[model samples]
Target: MSVVQAMDLGLTFPAGDGDVVALKDVNLTIGKGEFVSFIGPSGCGKTTFLRAIADLEKPTSGTLSVNGQTPEEARRARAYGYVFQAAALYPWRTIEKNVALPLEIMGYGQAQQHERVRATLELVNLTGFEKKYPWQLSGGMQQRASIARALSFDADLLLMDEPFGALDEIVRDHLNSELLKLWDRTGKTICFVTHSIPEAVYLSTRIVVMSPRPGRVTDVIESTLPRERPLDIRETPEFLEIAARVRDGLRAGHSYEEEHV
Candidate 1:
């Protein structure tokens, strides 16, 4: 099943004197169980497109469907889980409690909430730290907890916006590995946005490259590497080839604008 479908999707923001186009002529399809990453420069509509999927932003033109329904309809059905760049955890709540917050709001009973929290925490390898607070955990651990919370409801679609961009290199690498394992085990459709070519190439089944302002997809590169990727894979020739293609796509986008001007 196609989890997300967009056809000539466009979004424009009305500025003081004119309008700013965030996304334009974006046509894409994300299938079930696929890990798709959006990569682009600043002002490119990577996150904007993501937010449109979440119904956080409405498109001004074209058609978009999530699981065969409108984005707002999909959102109302709780069809996806979103993880922001920051952990965004409540320092006052215990790890388990934080994971259960969504369930609680959804009217899940106490027993069911506890069960879901325990299982989700285990999925993120945070089983022993259930009682700890966010500040008590390391940055990486806290992000893991945040992911656990997102997974608590067992949503089939996971939307992550540079969830590891803030972490240190070593921590980001570790979390990236863990995230792939988590995705493999869960088989959730993931739509991630990132600026790092290596990160996009390492994690995605397909990478979407976009232009600058008035963002439009310039290329969609399907990954040739095996799904079971290790950190060492980044150093391989095939990996570097894909990275070079992504870099070239970004440069092409820039050159397109330069030629037009």
Candidate 2:
């Protein structure tokens, strides 16, 4: 089934001069259990498109649907979970308590919240750190806590905006491998936004490469790699081939302009 669908989607923001076209003529569909990555240079609207899916931004035109419903409707139904670039955890709350916040808001019973938090923390391999404070944990561990919080509600769709972008390469690579395993175990659909070609190619079942400014889809590359990928799989010829294509797509987008946040 299609978890997300966008047809001729466009979004623009009003500026003092006129307007900023963040995305234009964007069209794509994401299926259930698919790990799709949106890759482009900064200001290419990768994060903007992801935010549109989460109903954080309104499109000026075109149509977008999530799980057969409008983005707002799907959001009210709790159809998706969003993990921002930062950990965004509350320093005052325990790791588990932070993960339990959504459940509390949704009015899940205390027992139910407890169970969900435990399971999700376990899934992210942060089971033993439930009592730790966010500031007490390492950067990578804090990000895992944030991911556990997102997964706590058992949402079918996960919207991640470069969740590992701030981490060191060694940590990022490890988390990437762990994320694939978590996706396999849960079968949740994930929409990831990233600027790194190797990260996009390494982690996605399909890579959506976008152009600059009024972000447009330049290319969509499907991975030929197997599901059970080891970290070393990145060193294989097949992996390099996919990475090259993504690189070529970014070049084709003429992303030589200065990057914007």
Per model, state how many residue pairs clash: 0, 0
Tens digits of per-residue lDDT, candidate 1, 117-196, equal 98999988899999999999998999899999889998899999889998999998888899999999999999999999
**lDDT against true structure, model 2:** 0.94
**TM-score of predicted structure 1:** 0.97
Task: State each model's C-alpha RMSD to the native.
Answer: 1.2, 2.2
Residue-level lDDT of model 2, residues 139-252, one tens digit each, is 999999999999999999999999999999999999999999999999999999988888898889999999877778989999999999998888999999999999998887
| Cα lDDT computed for each candidate against the true fold | 0.94, 0.94
Measured with C-alpha atoms, the lDDT of residue 192 in candidate 1 is: 95
* Model 2: worst 10 consecutive residues (lDDT sum): 252-261
